[model samples]
Target: MSVESIDAHQHFWDPSRGDYGWLTPELGGLYREFGPDDLKPLREAENVSRTVVVQAAQTVDETRYLLDLARNDSSIAGVVGWVPLDAPNAADLIDELAREPKFKAVRPMLQDLPDDRWIENPALAPAIHALIKNNLAFDALIFPRHVASLKIFAKRFPDLRIVIDHGAKPQIKDGGAGWQIWADGMAELAALPQGLRCKLSGLATEAAPGWTTAILKPYVDHLLKQFGPDRLMWGSDWPVLNLNGDYAQWHDAARQLTSHLNAPQQQALFGDTAKTFYRL
Candidate 1:
């Protein structure tokens, strides 16, 4: 069988541009320039037919940058760009980006912020609705604490398609102290309309450095149980995975996790779900 795969999450950044201020040298491995060329070898090695590039910085310019890249590169099947959801012309931004067919969705990096910032901010709600109005998905880059607010947002806007990134970012490295909070929140979010799904990437990074699938199994199993295989998708989170492991290592772990599932279910996790949800 051909090893066709679709990477649903990965990022690109240019250090000369000074865009990713958060990427410090102390973080070690992933603090260098990462672009399409850096990803090509790994994609070919793993047989990834296409990839969905998610935004790393919070700038509209980054959105346009990815759109331009997608226009030139067929390997980049879609892009999850960022826009100022609470800015004055948020609706206009969404509408404008929707004109680009490769602009599959928008993501605000809410997970890295303080717990209470824009979880349910009134101003951002309308902007989120504008995403739905324009037929775009919203990637929820949220932590466990933000899940409750995410539940509220999902219920309030039943029509919007939202993909939960990083398996709701469970606290694997923290001895799973925050697992219950994340699991409960995921249950609530999963109960929302069929639009809700989660990405099975970044789990190894979430664990302590040099962590293994045994360390990540609980969190992965929990998401599969809560969202089911059809509502789940796989993402390599490459280059970023260099912070903890390599692309092959991460991909193998994901394959091991779902090795028991039948062929169709495995296909959804590998590619079809993302293609269907993101309209790639």
Candidate 2:
């Protein structure tokens, strides 16, 4: 079966807006501005017709900005915006954001937080439950250190739709040490009867100086075995991907990496699963 491809994860930000505080000068090539116009041609050249823009800043205005961008750009299918989960009115904020049809999910910057157990904070319960009540997905944008917490979070809210972004961001540069721990945590989340999905993106950024499809394939293969095609999706992770690679390069590499799969399976990995998961 043929599928219209959707780039499940990418970001757009304007430094002039002062929202992306993390996009510091140290980021070099990625510190500059990136927007839909910059990404449109690259994605179009690769035949990726649509994309979901994830939030790059923790500010709620950044989410509002993305929703506005999606409102004007048809190629932008949906957004995974940020919300202050610990706020007393987080559920109210989620309900307000849910009114926008393009606001498909929420991603708290878990990797940056000092506390690994931040998700487990009782204060976050309302926001997490609001996600389920609003029918919005939760994009787990975390590193391997936080994977164990994710297993606990999933168990506590089994019915909430969750997708592990960047294969839980394993450390691949040094032969992926502590991989067993990541695998064990991922297995725990996948074991949830409510189901979970993983994205096959951001490995190149994680691997950095030593990045290669061959080095990344084992990790992708592991997720394939754990979640299957029906629960896995692909993402470009865009301009951030430019730190190590470009959109076209990652797109081509991802296609070649998953080339072993049959047509139906490939369709799901490249497009269908994201479309279904994000309701694109």
Candidate 3:
């Protein structure tokens, strides 16, 4: 299979594995096993040629499990697994993980951590350096409040290819609550010299129930204005997307929202940009 329309940020997890601390029965339909098999047909329906499976659990074992899955599933073009950046031997772990052919990036679950400024810690320099040395991307999974510190981190490590996951997960669920803050923060990051990128995923989950493409258009439009299609990439956010919508629904909504872009620009958002950012 070749890379064309890539789902740049989706995930798979087995609650039975007991690794995903955040997964619980309360999440309803999302509290079950979701693998490539479950998403394969849906992605095929939408012409998603390949996918980048991301981490759901914050454990290295889970990261290894995801890589093992990718090793066997050719459709999985990349894996954004996790490593404890605050650990003493984080550099060693990163070195070991980077040796895997499918490990394209490392996400530290920054959103779940209580410390919004965790990524700005100086203690993480060695691990981050190892990431730069290994030529891997950094997935910043954060909320609106963490944007300031992330900017500082981006400034300090200009060489680290940083990607803001879910557009820093804007507060879209509450009618774009704090719109100015999210907008200004995203614009600031986009203007930075580091060339920080962002994923066009997980917005459905962040949106209000019964949300439509119209509700997401403003946020997506803002992203295009800031990062442009060359720096933005599309993703499904899949099973979690079930929280608000489903796979095909979100894909359709994304297509509808971006329908106005010309062929080249649309291609960049759906595939080319991710291909370049993740070096797929």
Candidate 4:
């Protein structure tokens, strides 16, 4: 009944490689340099046997770099790399990336942008279509206001698998507590048939510093109700999570959330959901 764990949303970046512009000194110690070697200790400490390396920079090179890292390191089970959705040859790029078994999905960072923009822009539709055709999933990383866009995008591409990262990134710290907007949007997205999953990750970062499970419970509870354990997955968000807590703390928090669930349910939340959705 003991379930093996997988950290579904960790990030590794080499500042010397000149990519992560957001890691500033004000954010504290962990941002200096994060790589596979640095994450090994955390993995051991948390009993996490597998991980998914998510893209931090807005480049395909990051994806290729993670795939190469995965080739050398067995711990990284998958890579959620980014690609320019508006690019003309995005379809071809996805086709090529799919050839690598470790490349599981694509993520375009949509949270930083404005709310009115369409994810299914005419130019991006072909690329999205290619993702569906190639069996690659798309990670919907958006803010609360943009959550409603998923409804439009999901309706446009019924065959594509979509994962809402960081529980649609609610503004929990800002006291956006009512959550009517995010909760309604999540419900609409989950109703889609193709496949919709949500990551129980990054909540600590979104909440006030020193926030505890009690503070995060409302958002986590909402996701559990909307997606259920079957559609929910766990992720550490690693170095970013270091902003609020260490890897062990975040892993333990997830474990505490699943403490009441049966072993099979725990397995699905900890690893199986990600494995099945991302084909890891």
- Evaluate all candidate structures by whole-model CA lDDT and list the values in order: 0.86, 0.90, 0.91, 0.84
Residue lDDT tens for model 1, 1-280:
7645899999877766667768778877777878888899988887788999999888888788888888998999999999988898998989888999899999989877665447578788768888988889989998878877887778778888999998877888889787777889888888887559999988887889988888888888888898888889899877788878899899988989889889989999999889988998
Report each candidate's C-alpha RMSD, comma-separated, in the order given: 1.5, 1.2, 1.4, 1.6
Worst 10 residues of 1 by lDDT: 111-120
Q: In terms of lDDT, which candidate is strongest?
A: 3
Clashing pairs counted in every model: 0, 0, 0, 0
Over the stretch 2-111, how does candidate 3's per-residue lDDT look in tens digits?
Answer: 44799999999999999899999999888989998999899999999899999999999999999989999999999999998989999999999999988999999988
lDDT of 2 by residue, 40-110 (tens): 89999999999999999999999999999999999999999999999999999999999999999999989
Query: What's the lDDT of the predicted structure labeled candidate 3?
Result: 0.91
Which is better, 3 or 4, measured by lDDT? Answer: 3
Q: Count clashing pairs, candidate 1.
A: 0
Q: How accurate is candidate 2 locally (lDDT)?
A: 0.90
TM-score per candidate: 0.95, 0.97, 0.97, 0.95
